[model samples]
Target: HACVIQLPFNQKVRNNPDFFLRVIAENASCCYSMLKAKNPGFTLGNRGASGMFPSEAAEWLCYHAFTVKLSNHKVVYKCLLKPLKFCHWGCFKTGALAVLCHMVTVLANL
Candidate 1:
């Protein structure tokens, strides 16, 4: 399942300034888990058209995106390693290649 959150350009977010960032920070793990369950190999892509927002809002969104990506990587890394502890070097190589492929896909999408 894909989830999309649309925040209206409203006075509350404008007044609080960091509200959007705070929300993302607090929910990053939840979002990551939800998406990961939907697709274990989930990769984060760029925020297209995010530049259209005001600089402050756009910057905050970028920061939030960074945090979410970091959180997602942490979860994915842990999951990837869990079953590899008993595996041989070849499995490690395969896991590394998978991670590289995921990174390349993300970059390509950007």
Candidate 2:
């Protein structure tokens, strides 16, 4: 509960234990990585590159916790949703991604 999630920007910037904003990256490392690709250094004022991606991350956290897929669980939702003024994005962005679609359709069709 006291751990941090480092965002792509934060990861590239070297190290800052505040990127816990990863709850927003939504396990989408690609997007997360791309979002911080432009700014390859530490964040300035708010430990973020005054841009859309960082804001997106913040916005995501306001309604979610951990970089897991969206769910109907209240506890999970609220946890992921709890907004942190700032956090690390690199942590949650590290794991592998699961296929989000239902494979049953393809299998049944086959």
Candidate 3:
């Protein structure tokens, strides 16, 4: 199901980068927390440390192309797309279809 939705979500982000950035910025706390938890070091601040700040993370997610591995390890960090898609799917399933539809309509109008 996630794989099915990923393509459209990726295209949406590509088509509306600014809109997706705003959406991500609105949920900055969630992004920050998740990133901090995943990378407990200076990874959030130092771009040289295979690290990415929140905005870069957002941009990477928008393009569906971020592949920063942990320092000296093979573990690839999690992408924001997974959680975002989970939340979206959950909302759509839990009586938020109208709201989502309205969002789609708004996006379409843009």
Candidate 4:
């Protein structure tokens, strides 16, 4: 239950006794998606470190991408992690469709 703090859970997961597990799975999937997007060459699926913290990875990846200083022949790490806002701007209409597609696929298999 230490993982998967946030996700778009179904009403079943949100209202039922299996809420925690559902959350964990959603959080795991989010982590998996982000890692896959960032490091496409890495083969990560149902396998990962025994325990992976999304917040920790989120902080690390955010810093690595947004912070750190790069200059000619020089790279420096300030090692400061900032509190981040969970905001995603721009239209995500297509993303919603992708989610719908995946949901349909899952339901079809079931």
Model 2: how large is the Cα RMSD against the reference?
A: 14.3
lDDT of each: 0.38, 0.35, 0.43, 0.34
Cα lDDT tens digits, model 1, 34-79, are 5446764534332331222222222333333454444454542333
Residue-level error in angstroms, candidate 3, position 93: 36
Pairs that clash in candidate 4? none
lDDT for model 1 comes to: 0.38
TM-score of each: 0.27, 0.21, 0.24, 0.25
Candidate 4 residue-wise lDDT at 43: 45
True-vs-predicted CA distance for residue 14, candidate 4, Å: 12
Name the candidate that leads on lDDT: 3
What tens digits encode model 3's per-residue C-alpha lDDT throughout 16-98?
Answer: 44554455545544565676788776555422223334333333343332222211122221334455455444444443344
Tens digit per residue, CA lDDT, model 4, 22-98: 43335535765777688766543332221222233333333233323211112221111121112111112224324
lDDT of 2 at 40: 66
Clashes of each: 0, 24, 0, 0
Q: Is candidate 1 or candidate 3 better by TM-score?
A: 1
Better of 2 and 4 by lDDT: 2
| Candidate 2 error regions (>4 Å) | 1-30, 36-46, 55-110
